[model samples]
Target: MLDIAEELNAWAAEGRDFAVATVVAVSGSAPRRPGAALAVDAVGTAVGSVSGGCVESAVYELCRQALADGRPVLERFDDDEDDDDEDGLGTGLTCGGAIDVLVLPVHAAGPVRPVLAAALAATASGGAVALARIVTGPPALLGGALLVHGDGTRHGGFGGHPELDDTVAAEAAAFLDAGRTGTVEVGGRGARCGSPVTVLIESAVPAPRMIVFGAVDFAAALVRVGKFLGFHVTVCDARPVFTTRARFPEADEVVVDWPHRYLERTATDARTVLCVLTHDPKFDVPLLRLALRLPVAYVGAMGSRRTHLDRLERLREAGVTERRLAGLRSPIGLDLGARTPEETALSIAAEIVAARRGGTGVPLTGAHTPIHHDGPLGVGSPA
Candidate 1:
């Protein structure tokens, strides 16, 4: 949802109205990721999104209804959602993906705001957070939400029974540190044995991380661009003299250390990005060698086609393979005809985004693969 819970809490705090649209599940090709969201405020204001366009207008209308009646909605958009043209947004999934959405009308709900605010803080600060929504019945089921921290303690609940709280707390603790979402079945506790508790657990880290090795001019520029693109940018160079706070002020931390050793200790998750900007072969060769060994999401080394080719041969002699070598975005960046440092930075950033999103940077009409891949739910997969 990308800070969406916070947005709803904010809207409620101001006495303004907002509706949360959630993608509960999907059965076919879905354009947006599962945690996709769209929030509409009292005055038709909106934040976040649910789909490409097929059902957003319907969602907005429902948001208005939610504001009017103070009600929560569970809406499912199925394969038959081919209706057209509402509120000038038009309709249809040109990408050919079916999606499901759940819209909940929001009120301050007292602790709902503070609990979710704590959640937002945990997410923004790189800590993990989880929430259990008693979708069916509860001591406070209908509008109740629980916030669990990464460490698995009772911080806040939907003002429910202590038994229900303890049961959900223990069951949900494992999910707190796991930055993925899932459905946990907590039906054996005191509240009711057969009734289920649906926990929506989301653990957000401090943006995707990118450590640029060797704080040269390109390193400085890459740090700025990386931060703009929501990376926890770090600038590292072994030579303390070249690595300075003044050269890379945009960087979150300027470290003077051998790049390979630092990443080996800190990098985790496929979301981490590593950029080796030192053109010097002594540093670049080893940096590239180390990056190839990690499971990071993206790794790019700054150098020319010739320089990259030569480095690859050296890597091959040192026993690195073609599969790993293919992962490197050499002569890094897009085909943006970038000539200067700033332009090159933009191109590199664009390429990274494209790779992250699985986009080919080509026109949709000319592409053969479906615009939308099978989302987490595998909406189109045959059962």
Candidate 2:
């Protein structure tokens, strides 16, 4: 699946035949969302996971069986252990949820192999692509796939009626535009007639942006953490000497322009997170003033308690509204008694993830909150 595209792409390039089991639907408290996959190669080597660990062994065997028979299969695993008699695999998820997985073999001569390979290559290269496959349909149409690109181009087909392909492509394009991965139902023979078919649209978009504004040591550690979180990180500081590739090697880009100036021209979306580490009034005021007003996921600034108060006054004097300032995460990062740069970066990254996933900055051991919050499921998720 697109989640493990890089590793799967490498396997495909090496001419290794494999079978992949991808989660197409999920319900209740499933640990993994849709588009999560587990793949096993001809040599029984495995990569990636569908459930965190609950049903991996069963999914692994399912992949091996798929490779052996060259037939696509759709199986459901749930928390009902008593239902083992229904399926011979007898695997039950203990996560108090259910998932539907589609297993398909990717042999060199398989009709769907090339399309899968193309999708893996595009996704690994950071190109926007969507793979739409039939999760439930007629016998011949099951597991058939179509690859849709960002530019509205498409390759492969479901081998269904022409209208069915057109309808699925259009729906897949719409999902790709929103960077959404889920299911869309359509009639079998085009939009007009026949049995209903469910197509799973898995989208692979470029990672969201994490712009760290400052070139201090904390920024270096934050860059590494941001990259670890699958963000295309950018480090921007007006001081060219401090902003260098050597200092923040993990950052995708190092900008020498003023923080506000660079952000003014950069492409950002609701998913982008802005971290302002420059505590100087000049840089902090201008940057925070702009960042707080932007439609970004997070806007955090690093400063001391005294410095935070002073910066707040300066921003208020700069005409920033109280509502806008309310969004600012001054004195950035959760409280963990952080002393070192790495520890501070961890705190900051934890806060950012907490904000994005709607988590409280509190210990979970004694808390009654759900481990996974009901937050927005980003691209490639079936929420």
Leading candidate by lDDT: 2
Residue pairs with backbone atoms closer than 3 Å in model 2 (clashes): none
Q: How far is 172's C-alpha from truth in model 2 (Å)? A: 1.6
Per-candidate TM equals: 0.74, 0.92
What value of lDDT does candidate 2 attain over all alpha carbons? 0.89
- lDDT at 260 for candidate 1? 70
Q: What is the C-alpha local distance difference test score of candidate 1?
A: 0.68
Displacement of the residue 217 alpha carbon in candidate 1, Å: 4.3
lDDT of 2 by residue, 224-312 (tens): 88888888899999998898998888889999998899999999987788999999998999888888888888899999999999999
- lDDT, candidate 1, at 204: 44
- CA displacement after TM-score superposition, residue 34 of candidate 1 (Å): 2.6
lDDT of each: 0.68, 0.89
Total clashes, candidate 1? 5
